[model samples]
Structure formats: C-alpha cells, structure tokens
Target: MFKLLLRRFFSLTLPLALICAAGFGLDWSALALADQAPPGAQIFELHCAGCHIHGGNIVRRNKTLKLKALQRNGMDNLTAISEIVLNGKGNMSAYQDRLTEAEIQSVAAYVLEQAEQGWK
Candidate 1:
C-alpha cells in the first residue's frame, strides 16, 4: 500500500511539474522574441499570421496588404487598420479584447510600415 501511494504521487506530480515548467518557458521565449523586432511585427505575427501570411490575406483574395489593394480599400493608413483590427470587419474577428490599445496601435503602425516596404 505504501509503495502504491508513492508510485501514484510521483506519476502525477512529476508530469504536473514538467507541464508547468514548459508553460512558463514558452511565455519567457515569447517575451524575448517580441523584443527582437519592431513591436508591431511581433504582435502581427502572433495575431495575424494565421490569415495574413506575408501580408497576403488567404481568406480574401482581393483584400491584401499590397499598396494598391490597401489604397483601394482605404486601409492604407494606421487609423483605418486600427479600426478594422479593433472592431473587426467581415471575416476577421475583433481584437479589441485580445490586444491592448497599444498593441493594436503597434500592429497598425507595423502594417503600414511593412506595406510601404512592399512586404520585403
């Protein structure tokens, strides 16, 4: 009976400790990488990469980050992008709760900058 209890304790506690450590480690890595780039780029990667890979929207054929497309949609500026990000339009979900105001600003700034650079 003593051996059984010891085995059970180790089996549960060991995995639990490992899982906690991994979660903390991942968070630390995210913070470190976030500092390496312009704040917006990092935030964009975390939130937008799934759909807007390389500034090309997979979900929308016409709504891309290319200069001409953005200009056509009136999304070539920070304010426009911020509004879309905050309120979400069409298929995109709103990030108002998921990201802070500063983060949304950063992403908006980043998108415009990247667009000017032609997404290089």
Candidate 2:
C-alpha cells in the first residue's frame, strides 16, 4: 500500500510541482526579472489616460481615439497612428523619446484594438 501511494505521489505531485515551477512557481532567472515592457493598456494609462480617458480626448474632443474619429482623421491604420505617436501632432506631444520604438508600436496597436472594440 505504501509503495503504491508513493508511486502515485511521485507521478502526480512531482509532475504538478515541475509544471508549476515552469509556469512561474520558481522563475528567478535574471531574464525573468529583467524589466519587461509594459503592455499597451498600461502604457496608455501611464502616459495618455490623463488626456484621453476611456479613449475620449479632453484636449481635442473631435480627435478622440474612437474608430470613427480615427478614420475621419486619416488615422484609421496602424502606420498613421504610429506616426502621430512617434512625432506628435497639434496638441499631442511626441513620444519618440519617452517610449521605445517597440513601446510606441505597442501603444499604437493597443489604441487601434481599443478603438475597434469601441473602447469598452
């Protein structure tokens, strides 16, 4: 009986522990600890939420992050949005220095995604 129980424990608990460790239960590597880039939503919250809460632009109400507004303003695509984010336009300040290229792209993609989803 003890032998059977021990075999069950090894087969089940050991594999579960290993799986959990692989899934962050024991991830202490420097690569894991290295600063991972914040997601688009987080970036938006930190840098744009103050001015563009819920995709509504307080500075330029007409130029919101909404899909319709983006389309109407010739910013319906990722390239256009990325350009604005990289260089800024009108009331918006450039984020070229504040964010890495990847981050800018991520934020741009996030904006497009949120816009497509109606910012809900």
Candidate 3:
C-alpha cells in the first residue's frame, strides 16, 4: 500500500514540476531582455530620438519632445506609454514586433518615473 502511494505521489509531482518548468521557460521567452540601458531610455533612443531629438542631439529636422510634453501627452503612466510604444502613433513606427511586452512596460515605467518627475 505504501509503495503504491509513493508511486502515485511521484507520478503527480513529476508532471507538476515539469509543467512549472515549462511555464517558467515560456515566461522567460516572452520577456524581452535586449536593452542594456533603462527600457524607456533605450526605447526612446532607438525609436523616438531619431526624429524627435533628445539628450541635446539633433538627428532629424523635427521638434524635440521634453519630459513635460511627454507626460502631458498621456505618457505619464506605464500602461499608456506601453500601448503607444507597441502601437506607435502619428509619424512614429510601431515597435510591437521589435520589442516584447515586458520591454515596453519596462521602458514605459522608466520614462514615467525619470522623465515625468522632471517635467513638473
């Protein structure tokens, strides 16, 4: 009877452990970890700075966006900014495929936390 119970326990535990491992693997794959810098700053440098200008650099002939303008424009929160980065707007191109949801959220958080505070 004890042997049968032990076998049953192993049977259940083995699959459960495998499932958990698989879930973790899937999560790791889903999370984007490409940015070596802050996510928001990286996103801006890669996507926005090209045309909007940033950090005292003028790469294009467009108007620059300061922190205040970014917050007032609804990028004050991570969720809103994430959607914008993922979907893109106006003349901006979408980064949905280029960045994962995690990357978007991280970048959005960084922008809101560091940039918005200075805007006020």
Candidate 4:
C-alpha cells in the first residue's frame, strides 16, 4: 500500500541524505583548514598583520619586534607573546576565544622565530 511505500522511501532517503550531508560537512571542514596558510602564518595574517606588519608595531612605534624592543619589553619569548595574545595587554586585543590553543602556540612560535631572524 501507499503507506508501506512511503515508509520505505523515507527509510531509504533519510539515511542517504544524512550520510551525504555528513560527508559534505567533513569535506568542507577539511578544505577550509587546508586553504589556510600554515597555522602561525595564517593566524598572524588574520589577527596580527594589520597592526604588526612585518613585525613592526604600528600602534606603538617603539614596540617593534626588532630584537632590542622585544628584550626591553620582556616579550622576547613565546611564553610572553602567548600570554599577551591570550590576555590582551596594552593596545592589542585578546584572541583567546577567537583562536584555538594550538593556533596561539603556533603564532607565538612564529613571532619568536621572526623576531630572532630580524623579521626577514
């Protein structure tokens, strides 16, 4: 009867639709992650680049990542930078909720590396 046919159609199509949607969602997430630059580079571009272009602080002219500035401000290490990113010290905004912990770690490392290398 039509009732049986309707049940069969629903049973068959509903699971198929769910499976397809799940697959599509996973694929989209993977693609989105892949499209981003490396964790640190991507995070920097998204959050830090506007003000700290090339590791120079736009808001605080004396607070550049140029080795001396970092040492002077006690921000010459990943721990300090990560703390800043999380807590939002001075002119910077907090990214604790906006980014994952892994991302914070990555960008912190990146900042240290860039500073050590003179931002080249």
Q: What TM-scores do the predictions have?
A: 0.71, 0.68, 0.50, 0.68
Reference-based lDDT, residue 101, model 3: 83
Residue-wise lDDT of candidate 4 within 1-120, one digit each (tens)? Answer: 999999999999999998998986756667677676577977888899899999998899998877889999999988998999888887889999998888999999989988898888
lDDT of each: 0.91, 0.90, 0.66, 0.88
**Model 2, span 1-120: residue lDDT tens:** 999999998999988888887897575675454445458877898898899999999998899999999999999999999999999999999999999999899999999999999999
Whose lDDT is higher: candidate 2's or candidate 4's?
2
Q: Which stretches of candidate 4 lie over 4 Å from their true place?
A: 1-36
Range of the 10 consecutive residues with the lowest summed lDDT in candidate 1: 25-34
Runs in model 3 lying further than 4 Å from the true structure? 1-36, 55-65, 117-120
Model 4 residue 9 CA deviation (Å) reads 38
Give the poorly placed runs of model 1, Cα more than 4 Å off: 1-35
Error of 2 at 27 (Å): 25
lDDT of 1 at 26: 56
Candidate 2 stretches greater than 4 Å from native: 1-38
lDDT of 3: 0.66
How many angstroms is residue 77 displaced in model 4 relative to the true structure, after the best TM-score fit? Answer: 1.0
- Report RMSD (Å) for each prediction in the order shown: 6.2, 11.7, 12.8, 8.8
Q: Residue 43 deviation, candidate 1, in Å?
A: 0.6
